[model samples]
Target: MKNEQIVLAQRPEGLPGDETFRYEDTEIKKPDNDEVLIESVYISVDPYMRGRMNDTKSYSKPFEIDEPLNGHVVGKIVESNHENFSEGDVVTGGLPWKKFNTVSSDAVNKVPSTEVPLHLYLSTLGMPGHTAYGGLLEIGKPEEGETVVVSAASGAVGSVVGQIAKIKGAKVVGIAGGDEKVNYLTETLGFDEGIDYKKDNFSEKLAEAVPDGIDVYFENVGGPISDEVFNHLNTFARVPVCGAISSYNSKEDNGPRVQQKLIKSQALMQGFLVAQFQDNAKNASEQLAKWVQEGKIKSEVTIAEGFDQLPEAFRNLFTGDNFGKQVVKVSNSLD
Candidate 1:
């Protein structure tokens, strides 16, 4: 089989342009022992993936120039020599950006498709959902009737965070870029209030939304929005820095540079990866799946059809053009 892959053409200096990525074609090798040959179905495009576009090293290694950029993907196994997998099994994992992948069995998880749709494995039932769960419960530590705010509240992780906060009995407020997303947050996701960060009176509006002050701040996008939220934090508030997406492409990352607020409010600020709380991540996914099944939590997905749209789908995440979880639908049928 011939595989088409999206590669990192060069390290991005700031916001990635069209020149940042290039496409290449290669022949798909057959699965070796303990390996599986899978055809891509759903390709996840995320904000954190932008951080990997730079040459700098952080918790996750940078994507190499001229190499395939990999992220979470749901695929159907066509061939397998592994003990745990078989032909025609659906699975999800961190896979290379390609039409077909021959991968080690240990890297992929067999997805049981009795309940949710296959694409949910790339969104609400996947990594982004897990990130929201672990980050909010473990680091943010929200309590009943407390005010909780989530940035980028219309995006995948942020949307889940706000909904979960509401589930926990906290008064949830969402900070989004536009009025459409603000409406989605308030009407669809059931957030108590939604603030449009694009407005000139954003800080004042956020202040009005959270009159009691913020007890838990689920930090997704970090920039002017974060700086404004910091000013309204209550004493002993918790801040979970899940993703600094706003600063991902920039070389200098001064995350929420409001030192005085931190010092005065005695707020607890911690940055965490979902892997830090493995059990929580597992519980989060399971709970999110159940909540989605129960109609208690809404799962939103924005897919750019076909593998050919991968590059543009990814760049749209940085530009805030995608409303919910961004993924590419590689196949018309998962079967």
Candidate 2:
């Protein structure tokens, strides 16, 4: 059998374009001891992946030019040399962007038997969900009756963060780019108020939404949106820095310095990675799953069909073309 893979053609300076990716086909390799062969079902395309495309040092190692790109993937085991896995066992892990992957069994986690769609394992029940759960609960720590503001609130992590805050008895205000997404947050996601940052009077609307001032700010898209939020922060506010998608493609990141705002409010601002809370991953998953099953939390996914759509799916993240978690449906899972 042959496997097709997407590789990083070169390091991108600004936004990655057509020339950044290349496709190649090669013979599928057999799994050795304690390894399994997986056929991908759903592949995740996330904002953090853009950081990896840069050659600069960071939490994740930069993707080497000409090497196959890798991220979270939901797949089914086709062949297994590992005692723990069997043919057709669904799993999720960090794997190369390929039609098929031969990897160590230890690298993947078996998807629990649940009615939730397998694609969700690459979204809400996966990294995005985990990131929202850990970051908000650990750092934001919204209290009952407090006000919580989440930027890019219609996107994967921010969407989850808003709902969780609502569940915790806080007034949730979501900030997005358009009226459609703003409506999704207020009408569908149950947020108290939705602010469209692209509006001419965005700052004025944001000020009106959080009358009591923002107690917790789930920072996703930074730049001007974040500056407006900072202006309305109450004393002792908590800010969990998730990502700054606004600056991801910029040649130079120029934004307001927020040290004075932090000092005046005495707010706590911390940046985090999901792996920092690895010890409580199972507990977080169990809690999130329970919330999801009980309808206390809802997950939304925007899917692009075919493995060929991977690059486009990834590009959609920065473009706001995706409403929720953006995933590529590479193939069908085993029945």
Candidate 3:
């Protein structure tokens, strides 16, 4: 069998394009001892991966030029040389963007069996969901009845953050780009208010949305939207900087200078990686799954069909084309 893999042709100068990726077909490798051959089913595409594409010192290692781009993959074991796993077992973990991956058993884990849909394991019950729960509860520390404003509110992390805040008795205001996303937040997710940041008078509209000022600001996208949010900060607001997708593509740091606002409000601001709260992963997944089952929380995955669509779908992340968690469906033979 031949494995088709997508490799980074070159480091992106700005927003990644077709020129940045290349597809290669190579012979599939047989698993050795302590290894398994995974038939990839689904792969996650995230905004954070954009940082990894850059040749810079960051949280994750930069993608090597001419090598296959790697990410979170949900696959099924086709062959296992390890004692722990067997053929036909569904699992998920860090895997290469290839049809077949021969990886060590330690690099993957069996998917948590649940009545909850399997694809969600790569979305809401996965990194993005945990990122929201950990960043908001731990850093933002939202209190009851206080206003929580989330930038990029329709995104994977921000959407979960908004819903969780509502569950905790806080009024949630979500900032998204369009009216479609704005409606999704208020109508579907139960957010108290939705702000369309692309509006002609966005700053004015945002100011009107959060009359009491922002008590908890889940900072997902950082730019003019956040600059406006900063102006409405309460005396001691909590800001959880989960991501800055707004500036990930730029070599220049165009991030808004919120130092004056931070000083004036004396608000707490912290940047966090989901792995920092590893101890809470299991619990967080369970809670999110429970909420999902009860219909208290709704999850959406904007799937791009076929492995070939991966590059185009990946580009869609920066374009704000996807509504929620974005994943590429590589195969449909789950049975």
Candidate 4:
């Protein structure tokens, strides 16, 4: 049978442009011993993919030129050579960007028949969820009555971080790119206040939003917003660096100096990779599933239809065009 996929045609210099990717169709053999043939249902589009486009050193190796990009994908088993998995079992795993994948049985994790949708496995109950859980709890360690702030507050990780803070009894503030995202953060996500970074008085507005001074700043969209937030951090504040989506596409490094604040405030700042807490993912997933069931954590997914929309869907992350976890629906079971 034939499978269509998106491959990295060239290493991007700064931000990835359309020229960096190519779509191709090729033939694949049926599943062999201990393998399963999966028809992809949904694929994730995340800011971390931007780092993979560069040939520099990172947590994961850069994608080889001319190879298919890989990310979290949810699919159903159409053919199986293992006893544990059967036809029609929905699964999630790190799969190549393709219409179908032939993977070893050990490569994928079986999804439970929960009330949460399968797409949640690639978003809220998946890596981004764990990123928020481990980073905030382990690093930020926000306490009740403390002020907690997060950037990219409308995004998958930041949205979850803010809500988790609120659940912990902390006053939560959010910062997003535009008014729409700001509204979503304050209104839908239950943040106490939301700041639009696009506003002319962003720094001033951020100051006004957090009157008590930030006790914990969950850093996601770094750059100028991060710089402004740093200045308002209270003494002995904690900053957990999860991601920096705002600077992912920057041609050059730029941000306000924060060394003085770091010294005076005696604050703790740490950057973490999610894989470092792999030992806790299973436990975290279970807890997140419980939260979802109880309506404590709400997931927002922006789905683009078809495999052909992958490139545009990915590009949307850099422009703040996506409202939440951006996913591409490759093939629908409902259809």
TM-score each candidate. Answer: 0.96, 0.99, 0.98, 0.97
Residue 130, model 3: Cα distance from true site in angstroms: 0.5
Residues 15-77, candidate 2, lDDT per residue (tens digit)?
A: 889899999997799999999999998999999999999999999999999999999999999
lDDT (0 to 1) per candidate? 0.88, 0.92, 0.89, 0.89
Predict model 2's lDDT versus the native. 0.92
- Over 218-331, each residue of candidate 4 has an lDDT whose tens digit, in order, gives 999888778889988899999999888878888776777778898999999999989988998888888888888888898788999999899899999888889888999999
Candidate 3 Cα misplacement greater than 4 A, ranges: none
Q: Candidate 3 — which pairs collide?
A: none
**Which has the better lDDT: candidate 1, or candidate 2?**
2
In candidate 2, the residue pairs with backbone N, CA or C atoms under 3 Å apart (3 or more residues apart, or in different chains) clash, namely: none
Error of 4 at 200 (Å): 0.6
Q: Report the number of clashing residue pairs per model.
A: 0, 0, 0, 0
Task: Put down candidate 1 lDDT per residue, 1-335, tens digits, no spaces.
Answer: 67899899987777777798898998898888999999999999988888788777788999999999999999988999987988888999999999999989998999856357788888778888888888898889899999999998999899999998999999999999888999999999999999998899998999999999999999988877888888888999999999878877766766556778988999999999878888656667678878888887796889899897988898888888998899999986574
* Stretches of candidate 1 exceeding 4 Å from the true structure: 252-256
Off by over 4 Å in 2: none
- Top-lDDT structure, candidate number: 2
The worst-scoring run of ten residues by lDDT in candidate 3 lies at: 111-120
